[model samples]
Target: MTGRRVRVAVTGMGVKCPAGNDPEDVFRRVLHARPTAAVVPGLAEAGLPVRFACTVPEFDLAPYIGRREARQIDRATALLLCAADDAVAGAGGAVRGPGHRAGVHIGTGIGGLPGMEEVVYGHGERPMGMPVHTVPKSMANSPACRLAMRYGLRGSCMTYATACASGTNAIGEAARRIRDGELDVALTGGVDAAVTKVIVSGFARMRALSVRNEAPELASRPFDADRDGFVMGEGAAVLVLERWDLARRRGARIYGEVAGYATTCDGAHAVAPDPQGAMAAECMRLAIADARLTPAGIGHINAHGTSTVLNDLAEAVAVERCFGPQSPPVTAVKGVTGHLIGGSGAVEALVALLCAARGVVPPVATTASTPDVGALDVVLGAPRQVARRPVLSNSFGFGGQNACLVLRPAP
Candidate 1:
């Protein structure tokens, strides 16, 4: 175990998503085909183009964080802290390891834009004075710093800003460190609170946001013919990754094992995916190879189906090429959660683990049929029961960032 690649165990997970607050609740919503997309409160008043968003409900932050500290941080950072706290609680109240050997890595594409907006425009009729703590709250790396300082983690810490792939890459990189014996444990995931007016308007200008202002719930229809674009969403998810041997020795409840991870850049486009999806296909191939599992061994794939036509189609092509005609059953959580930006990948990874744990593949949660070019067995209508096997979760972001993770049932 000292010299070889150490097995990494997912000892704990915490989530604050539109689907639900905890992992089991989220899974139940997915299995029962509940959708969370709806109109965002402030966007319509601001005259934004796309008003709907998958917003996290009023989760009790007081239980996990102090009131004064909460006010000083942005919503995105607060979500990260809460998720981390839940991860520890999920791991039987504490992460077992020396503080010096544990690390934290959280991903966020943009931080505190909503807070910045509030400072400039105020929450009322009058513009408010800028808060002195604005810089700390808005920094992309704030979550990572807060986690480290609060948890007394002395190991490597980082915050990835790879657009939408940030969370996937963060978890993947943390797994790498544990597998490489650089650290014994790591808390890694993604967080983003991008449901602000300015953010939505900006994406609207790029034609990247869904404009089904009339029907909020139907806006994020991934892989559907009627799908226009993704709905904005805000949420966070964090996982505690421990070296498998250490987890076993401590008798920790093992949720699953991160067996493989691989990331690649499209290098072809800034705002769009490679029309051919060659790089994405290769990214999946490499992840499977890294897991030492054949493509056929993968039981399910949690797709990065943004519901945007171009992305869903490109990802489908990549899936077909990598898994061939007999591709695994695929599902997209974005149908329910919309696009969580950096948080999308991490939260979807959690869904992947839940699939393995429950021995079922959650349905697509969208009413539309899969497009012909991207036609694969997309689980829809109802959840499909299946034997637990390695699950592959994909995250593709703007600027061509692609990440894939292979999660295996705890052996």
Candidate 2:
């Protein structure tokens, strides 16, 4: 419907992750390569194979929402609500009124897993006293619906559930809608609170989770030669995207521009990525092209590095295929925050924007061993200074879902 798409500006961001709640604090922790993985409070007694995870520490919803309202929602919804509150506030409360065409788009892998596990598996035969709001809270669209209701966003309220790529896809889709002039403002991000016994045990049984119980903080070594598997992490991240002109008119503090976005499917496997990473490479190239940029234009890459042997190798190959021997410097936030599953992409997107604005790249905290893929320059140990340019953030998920976003520094 257009020749050149409208630019979407990122005006506000909020994060509730293992690293921290504030965006700046989280980025600082990531820059320093601080690891937050630790043993879950009750996992050891629960007898699960994997006992550790990167959990949001001491999160309380009372400050953001009333106690009565918080009681009806699940942990995932609570996290999203908290992040959304911060994001909306940070955006100077511009999208709240009924006059604006606002929307809510959220991504989540398994929404309300804790509630589902409790009501479904916890109650054996004691006449399960399910709460009235259990069904609503346990639904996969709970977070998105709750956010929309809270903000009074009247436009399309949608939810994406592409396993781990949920958050990135949500942000990309929302940006597209705004760029296409379908919406004036949007709250888009990813959130997941699935560090439950069922999820952890399932991953452990599949040999997809790290088994380093003694030293959980050092367990998630993405792209490292000695890396075994990813450690589960739970968190939420939300960003406020607005039409560039609207943001400028309002004098909003622009963090960056969502220049281009692309989503692709491997169509090769249900759980494992194609070792060749052909589709993944194509996705990256498509996103860069959509942004009117070339491979050489991208300054850095925030890899979808899950610490799993298969994912890291596949992603590395994809990067090499996309940019050849001159691949951009790469960093994996999973090393510090662990694998946030659906929320990882959104948080990493924020990190990429910060990197571009600050002219530096953070390190992959635990990746000390030689990188399995020697062709790529994986940032490690210390932050690397670089010129501000477009940053490519990647998110690949189960069932071969891949999403990429090209974020350009604000002019």
Runs of candidate 2 exceeding 4 Å displacement:
97-100, 126-128
**Model 1, residue pairs in steric clash:** none
lDDT of 1 by residue, 112-137 (tens): 67777777776345434567787898
Q: Alpha-carbon error at 202 in model 2, in Å?
A: 1.0
* TM-score versus the correct structure, for each prediction: 0.96, 0.97
Predicted model with the maximum TM-score: 2
- Of candidate 2, the 10-residue stretch with the lowest lDDT total is 121-130
- lDDT for model 1, please: 0.87
Off by over 4 Å in 1: 1-4, 93-96, 122-129
For candidate 1, give the lDDT of residue 347.
Answer: 95
